[model samples]
Target: MLNKTIAIIGAGNMGTSLIRGILNAQLTSAKKIYASGTRMEKLEKLKTEFGVHITTNNKDAAKRVDIVVLCVKAAVIRKVLEEMHDVLHKDQFIISIAAGVTTESMEKIVGKNIPIVRSMPNIASTVGLGSTAISFGKYVHEKQHDIAIKIFEAVGDVVVVGEQHLDAVTGLSGSGPAYIYMVIEALIDGGVKMGLPRDISTKLAIQTVLGSAKLVKESNVHPAILRDQVTTPGGTTINAIHELESHGLRSMLIDAVATATIRSRELSELINK
Candidate 1:
């Protein structure tokens, strides 16, 4: 849907995953995608693997692309922007994947009239299945929003959320994959304790977790109902569930989300300050 050249200013895990997705989706040709990093070795690795242009100059990357992706950590956003500020064109859209960095702060660096987008995407982008939320700044035109959506959607699902909710999205989805991984690991441990082989236990645990999520997606029924179907009264499932409740499983999950939300808010305040 687009022919505009794109440049990514970081070659880390998320950045590399985004590159893979963009190519797999055929959103742009390899020749049009550029990956940039300060490390020559990393840039060389991306160049060898993707056959795309790689560079160590952030300014050069910004100067040559229509859409510039800022994939660095939140703490590093200001530094990266300052380095590329002189070369950033007025027409370029700066799409930031840094958690907790707001569009308002980004605008201050790029000029309030320059287009900017702040987005949060989970790690699932590596496999072409991720959930992302984005907020647009004042200078982001309708066309720019469309382009931002296209770029994020190439990796996974994309939603445009109000700026106020970006932090909540970060807590809920950005950091959620790790929580899910913990649950999967605990389930595998349980299987292993039951005498199942470690590898088999882990495989079953992972697939079951994934399948359960797919069922929720494909079935219109409320999760509670689907859960109830498997949890017949006085059945083995209910017994296990009772044991979980005895150990405060549900409350622990709620506390986990709450803690993550509070921490995200703190980080946002720190960055904004």
Candidate 2:
């Protein structure tokens, strides 16, 4: 168990998801978690549901925590930082889930050389299968880094990368769920085209994607090699693979990631400005 008090500054979807993930994983006790937000009713509901402390005052929530998680919107991160500035000490750690908000911008606002972590967690976090990548500021120590990793690992997998590479992470895993959803949708439609009912098609497509991913993860095998394993010289799977290759599927996915990365950079520029 992580023996620390954590305050989630926003009681929104991502914040709530992280809170649930933490509690479900038994990382920390509910009483040690403080949730703050603008809506009293929602906060009260959360308090009843999770038995966590809930408050409307951001500073109050922030002042008494080992780690403060910034789960607020990207547009208001600066404002929230300023609001919590006086309360945040160097000993306290910061982990922001706000997309495109760089640690530098956070450092500039906090002005304490505090350890701030910029994290990108996709919407899959809502389901406890999130893919989160964390980038640290200059002041983070080894212990603090481990704490950050442990906190995120409650929700799902966590990877560490240079702060500069976060945009690509944002483009890939951060926005990857939607891309995969599209693929699943297409697969379901294809199954329907082949005379399968919509519901059955949906389930089959979802399981196929999930099982394939599980196989790749468990076997530690390259996807191309795995693809070859399912394919024969003159088989239906090869015929399907030929269609996907002919349609420039790989190239399109590459372009999609690159475009998303560039857009992430542009959004960061706008936010940091």
Candidate 3:
């Protein structure tokens, strides 16, 4: 928890979620938060819901906060930084959730050796279960890193990783929730094919996924071992596993992560260029 004022430069889903998470966890009070966005309607809604200061001026948001979170899109990170660079100072810490925008790129735009943190947090952050991986800029100190961790912990778990691994993190956890959603949909459809009602199938599939993930987390067991436990010598689950393996399910997921990583690298290269 922190007492310092914080600014979120883009009041979109992630930014809104951070405000909610911070308030829910009592990391900071509502009045200490400032959110900015292009859409007045959305910003007004956020103000009504979270009771935080709202603005259309990014520089105003940056001017007084001890920390500034850049939740804008990667393509607009440079523009946002350039717009607020005059108001930004070294004493303030910067955290950017814009995918593929490195701290080095941000530092270049700011032209100051500011404490910048690059974080990749998945969409699950909206529900306060996000898995976030963070890397630091050249000037970040231990105190700054601890503050960053506490801020992210309000939403979900946090991990410190080398900058080199961030692209892979972007591909895996950053894009992983979508993959799991697709899998859940497929599971629901499979239940429907087997004659279960649509609504019933949906609930069952969702709970099954949720319970399984919780088990893995709480039991601290290897996933393969858990699968083996669920699979008897000749059980229905084993049959399903065979079908999935035969259809290259595992390989498909692997390829998906790899492809995403490659694209992340390409996007980062574009921004750096």
When sorted by lDDT, best at the front, the candidate numbers are 3, 2, 1
Report the number of clashing residue pairs per model. Answer: 0, 0, 0
**Model 3: CA > 4 A from native:** none
Give lDDT tens digits, candidate 3, residues 69-138: 9999998999999999998999999999999988998999998888999999989999999999999999
Look at candidate 1 and give me any clashing residue pairs. Answer: none
TM-scores, each model vs. reference = 0.97, 0.98, 0.98
Question: CA lDDT, every prediction?
Answer: 0.89, 0.93, 0.94
Q: Could you give candidate 2's per-residue lDDT for residues 1-273 as a string of tens digits?
A: 887899999989999999999999888899999999999999999999999999999999999999999999998898889999999999998999999999999999999988998999999888888999998998899998888898888888999999999999989999999999999999999999999999999999999999999899999999999999999899999999899999999999999999999999999999999
What value does the lDDT take at residue 11 in candidate 1? 76
Give the 10-residue window scoring lowest on summed lDDT in candidate 2: 147-156
Candidate 2: where is the Cα deviation over 4 Å? none
Residue 11, model 2: lDDT of: 84
- Give the per-residue Cα lDDT of candidate 2 at 148: 88
